[model samples]
Target: MKIAESHPRRRVAVLSTVIAAIMLYLFIQDVFGAVKKQEETEIITERSAWLADWRWEAGTNDLEVVAGGLTSLQVFAAYFDESDSLLLTDKFREAMPRIKQLAEQNELNDLYLTVVNDIKYPNDTDSQKNTSLVTRLVADWESRSRHIDEIIAALETFGFTGAELDYEKIAEEDWPKFAQFIHELDYRLQKKGKSLRVVLEPRAPIERIKLPKGPAYVMMAYNLYGGHSGPGPKADAAFIRKHATRMKKVPGNSYIALSSGGFDWHSGTGKAVGITEKQASELATRSESTPERDKASGSLHFEYNDSDNVKHTVWYADGTTLSQWIDAAKAKGIQNIAIWRLDELGSESLEQLRIQPGYKIE
Candidate 1:
């Protein structure tokens, strides 16, 4: 009886091994086939012309009162990994009404709501998955994207013109494919009278080389000022000019009204004067320049935006002990001044925004 039972088990084990071998062979074949297909379409990305602009200057002049020029303001409500739907959650959803109310009060001209990252649709492709993790991310690319579409549709309920796009970090080699993907997505949005704009990180020059033209703004963020104080703005603007010159439109091929980059600073000059980062950052909450208390003087680069579209830059640091930064800005011939960032600034900063902001867009 024991021999008969063991004999059947041995046969079952042999069958299982055969099936496993066949599956392994099929997977290997599929891998090679995909690699071969990828190689065939490796050279299809198109390049466009570029323009340049920035505010981090060398030896500065008077360009102060760099706040309130924005009739349009964008608060990047980006989501953390796995938190993509946070924008739809209670806090964000609740905040949406308030946000729209604010925009209405300001009479905002344009609104761009980016649903950054891959789609999270239930049927999203495996390419959307991050294979690096053991547990795995819950939402796939298609699913995430679909959620954004759902949110986009719902946003229309608020009676605002909205746009959606994925600003995902993509590989340079896959740029052509990426462009094709975005173009298709944009096509879908156009049907709804909505548009999509792919956001980009300017610091990534290599990836920037692969980006397609259809974005409204370069959306410049990250480190800008105090880049080694060597070559200076005229030269930096030359390289920047290349990036901005060709990007004068969005997917519909319309001319972008304006192009913008920021003029930001770190508090090294503040530290020089022995003020803590926390304190300097706190004081900067108002447009009050830090009294050379170990801080670097800040300025704006409004040179590229063609008068009406640009405003002077505001700054605080140890090098500039000027109490009336507004006066200094007027001295530099800046006609319109604005605070650096609305998010970091408080009511004190907003009070400055109403100060009949100065002189010229020309």
Candidate 2:
């Protein structure tokens, strides 16, 4: 359908209008994107400031400050038998007063009485190596219920805010039963005005489990390299971020736990033993070896020779590495960061934490 062509001036006018509209649309989009970015930045800034203020208010210690001012503390106190009876440890009883004082002074809202089956006592060497007993505990409903009742009773008796189920190294086939037990325990605890927090290993299939809305799932994000493994960082940045991403799939709030300790590995036998920062430092000093930081893992390592002329490698996290862990978690939008054990932190590391900027959730 051929028709008379429009005048050249009319055609030019139409083209100009279309071009102007396109430009206007792009301008509005650009403005909106800038505003959104600005809002995100502002939220982050506010959260960081709030965390800093909380740190200032707590003033307990550097580790506590760096760890969000000790809102919660988990105590590894006892182990449960198939009969659901607790075998209390002397170490648990000994540490109670100190933990209580710390809670009172910091006004902490939650105290987790951690119970596990793999360990009969604190620092039990076979704890992580054995999982058969824990697997059995999760399989029986009666045993699980009895354990729940005892946990709630203990929480009440000790004035604990909640109970933390730290049954680790469960067989993959028993994950469903474990998830069910957690749900049941959480239900019971809620009725008593208490809470339940489950400690999941880094490799735990969190997606396969159904957690109650009330309890928080804490992922042990460290141990990427530990005493059981070859000489390496306890946790590298990439390892932490990988777990943090998986943790997001967990329901409700989740925490990223870090190790503040170190490991000593024998280069000759490839056997690694866990050590405290103090112990690592003492060994390094005796051997006259200076610790060097590995930029790739953000961890400090040093090589030293022992009395038998056996060369050894020690890899550990210091103030700088801990800060890097915190930053990695922060970048992943994780709000809570937990140190495996407060006692393991060295004085220097604590001081470093005190001077660093505090972290907070948006």
Candidate 3:
């Protein structure tokens, strides 16, 4: 009888022990699972800046103010001459010394030269983006080789760490050849211990295009609304997320270029001109109009009358807008960002770039 009673107590002890083990396992799992989820959600980012040739003074000044935060700097300085040879703009020539000084002081060795497709005629006539020139230049081997040589030579002469091709308005037929040229350039540049960056317009068929694997591809994400369109935010959350998704097809390290300004549209003439954040803010203050932030885009929009009593609509990205843009890009798994033509930026926006923020991936 005593032995049977002991058996029941022993069985009860075993069951209780099993239950305690399971409870301890559940407790440890819950604690560790929370940590793993937090680790997975944390996102970090990097930032770079473009110093425009046309606005080199302001760009240089702004860059100096934010140099400590930048990982690299691209001088938007090179263009095509009348003969399609590489030509450095006058402003770029003048700003080189100061730029070099800043780079050395800031330890920014990843200096790049950005060459655009624009051709400046000698007569000071209307300089334009010559898609025809691009077609002929890249489609023909002789021309393409010569152009690549010129770019490489310039990079060597100027000690640029890399070269950025900002060819815009490329005809659809020329894309294959353009892509071929990029591959060829990347090969040659790599041989010479240099790097290459290829900038794609918003309309580029990234999904179907077979771009070279070596070069860093930059997708121009801004310009959803610009001089070409009516007044609106330069970029919205949807626009950025769409391009960020589209950029998945682009090989290698890629960047989404965000702009930091807005446009003022005149109602009478239906003409819109670009304006900086400061300019937009000043206009709003002058007209005593409150700029309302667009919830969808995180951009500020307002209406004001000019001195001539012409009604105008302005849409611009401020510091808050930039932060929101960064978050939108992060949600799409893009961590590298480039600011287009960093000139006359407000302090808060500069801070956003400097910190290269770390946020939740979602």
Winner of 2 and 3 under TM-score:
3
Residue lDDT tens for model 3, 1-362: 99988998999999999999999999999999988987887755567889988888888888788888787899888888888788887788888999999889988888999988888888876366689879878977898899999999999888899999888989999999999999999999999999999888899988888998999888898999988888889999999999999999999988889999899999999889988877887888855667999998999999988888889999999899998997898789788899986888888888887774346464
lDDT of 1 by residue, 307-347 (tens): 34432222222112212343333333222222223322223
Worst window of 10 by summed lDDT in candidate 2:
45-54
Q: Go through the candidates in order and give each one's C-alpha lDDT.
A: 0.36, 0.70, 0.87
When 1 and 3 are scored with lDDT, the better candidate is 3
Order of quality (TM-score): 3, 2, 1
- Which residue pairs of candidate 2 clash? none
Which digits, one per residue and each the tens of the lDDT, describe model 2 over residues 98-171?
55665676566577777766444444543442477666666789877876778888898888888887777788
Local distance difference test, candidate 1: 0.36
lDDT at position 277, candidate 2: 74
Instruction: Assess the local accuracy of residue 228 in candidate 3 as a C-alpha lDDT between 0 and 100.
Output: 87
Instruction: Give the runs in model 2 whose Cα sits over 4 Å from its true position.
Output: 1-68, 81-84, 119-130, 287-289, 352-362
| Span of 10 residues, lowest total lDDT, candidate 3 | 353-362
